[model samples]
Target: MNLSILYRGPLSSCNYACPYCPFAKRRETPAELAYDRRCLERFVSWVATRTGDSIGVLFTPWGEALIRKWYQSALVTLSSLPHVRKAAIQTNLSCQLDWVDACDKAKLALWCTFHPGETSRERFLAQCRVLLQRGVRFSVGVVGLKEHLAEIEALRRELPAEVYLWVNAYKRQREYYTPEMIADLTRIDPLFPLNNTFHASRGHSCRAGASVIAVDGEGTIRRCHFIPTPIGNIYDPNFADSLYERPCTNDTCGCHIGYVHLDRLKLYDTFGDGVLERIPYGFGESKPFLENLSHAHLSTE
Candidate 1:
């Protein structure tokens, strides 16, 4: 069976200082960094041994991971593995683009986030252009802060139409956006309303433990990131026996990575093979899937 692993290591430091993010500008000591590196190497080595199963990995670190050299090497290593279907990561696009040249473009994808104040728009766009020129599969997104609405709109316009630009709803405050504001963002990103709502996920069927899972630095595996209960460990020999369909135990799942896997949402049909990388099927084409949004049956409470 094909398995999708959302791997988050112990690396929790970032160079950008986004006000809303807890990990912003956080610094890790040399010892901590070394430990994180070892954890990541162990995870990658474990992935390499899973030749009998098709594996797809997405590194969802607390801080920006692409900025580190080890992450770059890991992606390069994972992308070349014949058993690895895809190797992607959540990055801030702060790292140099040269490393991607060594990766197998077919299996290497990136989920890039654009922070307005952290970097200049021109610089970010330039990096995107490089990715485009390199034929790298990627998706760009930004937090839907009211203050950054103008920047978000400008980014959508400036980016290539083929490149999907997504907006992540800023839900830190209650009713943070007005109806008009939602409409404006919706026009830019047809999927905005979906991200804007908090999904009630308790007792809901999800594919987390069965086909997808979240793995921490120590190889502890959980159904998903929102749930802390350990279902198994990736290093355990009989770990495959523990995977099965399970209901979400959390009252709410607001994060895209968590809620997208809810069976009731039918997002798997929406994203198809691109779910791990956050790319919608036929995104740049005619986008025939957009016509089926009404049928997704997502419950937003």
Candidate 2:
């Protein structure tokens, strides 16, 4: 079955200690690093076997993932696959950009998060320049925090107008963003309102479980990160059959990746094919990959 999978590796080590995040910078033990490498390789091998089936994969690691050499190699490997319409990852953009030269930039995209104090703004912007020069499709984003308002606004000014800049709602500081603040952020990221709050998802028809899902390093697949019940195993032959429509069990779904599948949200109207890759889908652009996936979804229905 054609699927969109978010794979979060077991790597818990990060290089940044942002106050907003729990899993801060920590050193990974030699043994732990080895184990993580094995798990990631297993996932890569499994994905290779699914070459005939359409699959869009996003690596959502608990910690910074791009720092690992294997992860870099994996991104290049996945992008080269014909069936992999989208192979993207969430990163802090702290790593070197030279590795991207090996990737199929057409299928590769980055959901980059810019932390104000954690990284040097100049260095981050320089890396962004590399992506633009290489013609890589990517999106720039920052956490929506009151303290970071000025930095975000300044970033928006320096960033290219055509590039999509997203604002992620900070979970711990939900009350920090007032309506006026949202308006300011919205000016930089037109899609800011969508991320400002969680939507009621209970009993609503969502394509989450049936079309998109989360896969842990162990290959265990879940409907979403918030929902931990293992619906199937990614490596298992029966994995494809595990996909089916199910109502959200939670009251409100906040995660962009999860809520985007909610049919009622009509996120498709805004995101279009870009939802899968975390890039803006311009109305005038040709979404051939998404066009193919639409036909696939219709056939399955």
Worst 10 residues of 1 by lDDT: 292-301
At residue 180, candidate 1 shows an lDDT of 99
TM for every model, in the order presented, reads 0.97, 0.92
> Residue 14 of model 2: what lDDT?
89
* Number of the predicted model whose lDDT against the real structure is largest: 1
Q: How many backbone clashes does every candidate have?
A: 0, 0
Please give, for residues 133-163, the per-residue lDDT of candidate 1 as tens digits: 9999999999999999999999999999878
- Give the CA lDDT, 0 to 100, for residue 269 in model 1: 78
Worst 10 residues of 2 by lDDT: 292-301
Report, for every candidate in turn, its global Cα lDDT versus the true structure: 0.91, 0.82
lDDT of 2 by residue, 1-301 (tens): 7788889878988899998676787889999989999999999889999867898999899889899999999999999988888889999999988889999988998988899999877878888898999988888889988888899998888887667788987766548777798789877776666676777778888887788889988999899888889999988888878899988898888778887788876666667667865665572243532343232121101
What lDDT is obtained when candidate 2 is compared to the true structure?
0.82
